[model samples]
Target: MYYDLMQTGLVGELLITGDNDGLKKVCLIKGKNDFIIPSDWIRDEVLFSDVKEQLGQYFKGNLKEFDIRLTPEGTCFQKLVWDALTEIPLGTTVTYADIAKMIGRPKAERAVGGAIGANPILIIIPCHRVIGSSGKLTGFSSGLENKVLLLEHEGMEIKGSERSALVM
Candidate 1:
């Protein structure tokens, strides 16, 4: 059976969904269009106690890495990209090209960006750590504002400029 819960954290309200297999999604709810709970899923805060606590620690800047089990569904290439995303250390950012090279697809930078954009599990998976080769922030599924927030929360500096409004 799938279970889900809502937890308000540093970024905003998060809609977390999963089952016994593991967490399937942890999405930041920005608006009504951001998430919709399935009719068959049960809302059970008790099932997500650990996720809540860990996220709380993260927002508090007391946690750097996540140990939660995950079961994100995606294509094989996307999975490869997501898996590489998890290896990104805290307080550091990399480019899509870096991720492409990390996965042995040195020429698949664009494809890597597409996979990164498709990442379903956000903060825990650390998709927010990706930046442009020029050290500018790029697309984040939760929006660049939240991306800047997450990166800033991790102690990275975000500078603004006319050329690249958000440079890391």
Candidate 2:
């Protein structure tokens, strides 16, 4: 597999990995704010044009779900949780407990949260849609601020959590 990096106005740095088949991972760089592309990685803008376009549209609220192919690697349970994340509609929120129930593990809210954290594909998988049961904003691999920005871009009003209460 090879990797490429791109900087965006909304999500900062994104590390995209792929092979001959399709996209493997799209990780957001949350620390140091830089992507260190491996020596073997090929930096090809043509290979990631679609990804950039779709993400730009998403940030502008013109797109709801991504159409790019994905090949995220994870355990079976993690894959299950990530798949369930795709089912979460835009402009709405669901709790980790809700995902637990969806995966037939009603008492595995914590487990579901862990799986969500392991999601390799960030905004495309919609992990940001998961929140606390009390409608509070929870952890986001890309950071809570980006999570709030994403939710707001989707036109969802932040109503429950002070953490999401932007003074604007």
Of the candidates shown, which would achieve the greatest lDDT relative to the real structure? 1
Clashes of each: 0, 0
Q: Per-residue CA lDDT of candidate 2, range 1-168, in tens?
A: 677777767767788887767777888876673556677777777777788789878877788888988778899999999989999998888899999999999999989999999999888899988888767788887788888877887777776454755322
Report every candidate's CA lDDT: 0.85, 0.82
Error of 2 at 165 (Å): 5.3
RMSD of each: 1.8, 2.7
What TM value does model 1 have? Answer: 0.92
Question: For model 1, how does the per-residue alpha-carbon lDDT over 69-148 read when each residue is reduced to its tens digit?
Answer: 98999999999999999999999988899999999999999999999999989899999999998888788887788888
How many clashing pairs does model 2 include?
Answer: 0
